[model samples]
Target: MAGIIGRNVNGNIAYLTALEPALPGFITNDHKFRANDGAYTEVIHTNAGLLGYVSDLGHVDFYPNGGTDMPGCDSAECDHARSYYYLGESLISGGFTGRRCATYVGAMTGNCVLWGNLNMGGLVPKTGSSGIFYLETNAAPPFSRG
Candidate 1:
């Protein structure tokens, strides 16, 4: 089975790194990798919010509003906290959606002409998908325009 779940392993890097060679694919006897594995993503809070942690290899990386200074948030707290809000909203209401361009690099510049649409933070993962995504939300509750 897929083994040991770890997070923020900064302190244990050396130990973990040392064991990497000995372990077989990180010691997973039968680890199957998929695109939609648990909504893997890096959420970027526009404005006020810190750059925070980023996952370069996630199936989708959500950059809401495409800026650190989220449009509706009055303060940094609201902007940063919007990540949690977005997740909660996704569970109940229609989730936020992001539009990126053809390539990961092009998408970042806000040229969303391509069909790179992805829903951010969903109960079910978006399978067979991988790329950076961007979406805009309302300032208040029922944030999703969907």
Candidate 2:
């Protein structure tokens, strides 16, 4: 585990280290770091000096005011099961362009807007299949409902 060795303000030797991924873009399961392995986990810093997660399907999930979990859900709930919002295949082709985003099943909440396509952890009635969902927050209004 190679890492950068440096000293803190107090002059004591300190180590600033993070694990490097074995492969490029092959990371999974960790939320505090960039999944790209070589890349440092990036964050969006607010004017108020708050650090927020960036929107990356493989990296991290962004919620309103930079929050990560949807409010009012239980740990056993399927919605909070994952850290990142599940981007359905071909659901968002061009990526989030407006202020608001939506999901088919998972539960999330944040400062931006959101649209729910189906109940969290529920099967999609039209397809009869279970789905995962997560969406980043934006400053625009929601584009769809349900």
Question: All candidates' TM-scores?
Answer: 0.61, 0.23
Q: How many backbone clashes does candidate 1 have?
A: 7
Clashes of 2: 6
Best by lDDT: 1
User: lDDT at 128 for candidate 2?
Assistant: 27
TM-score of 1: 0.61
Lowest summed lDDT over 10 consecutive residues: which window, candidate 1?
A: 13-22
- Model 2: pairs clashing at backbone N, Cα or C within 3 Å: 64-110, 64-111, 65-111, 85-134, 86-134, 99-140
**Over 4 Å off in model 1, which ranges?**
1-44, 47-57, 102-109
Residue-wise lDDT of candidate 2 within 1-146, one digit each (tens)?
A: 12112111221222111211122233343333432322222111111111222233212222322233323323323223222222221134322212333431122333334443222211121222122233333322231122
Candidate 1 lDDT, tens digit per residue, 1-146? Answer: 11123233322211110000112232343432222223242333343124332222244556666544566777755565667777778778747778865544443455567665777765664555666766777878888876
List clash counts for every candidate, in order: 7, 6
Q: For model 1, name the residue pairs that clash.
A: 46-67, 46-68, 46-69, 47-67, 47-68, 47-69, 98-134
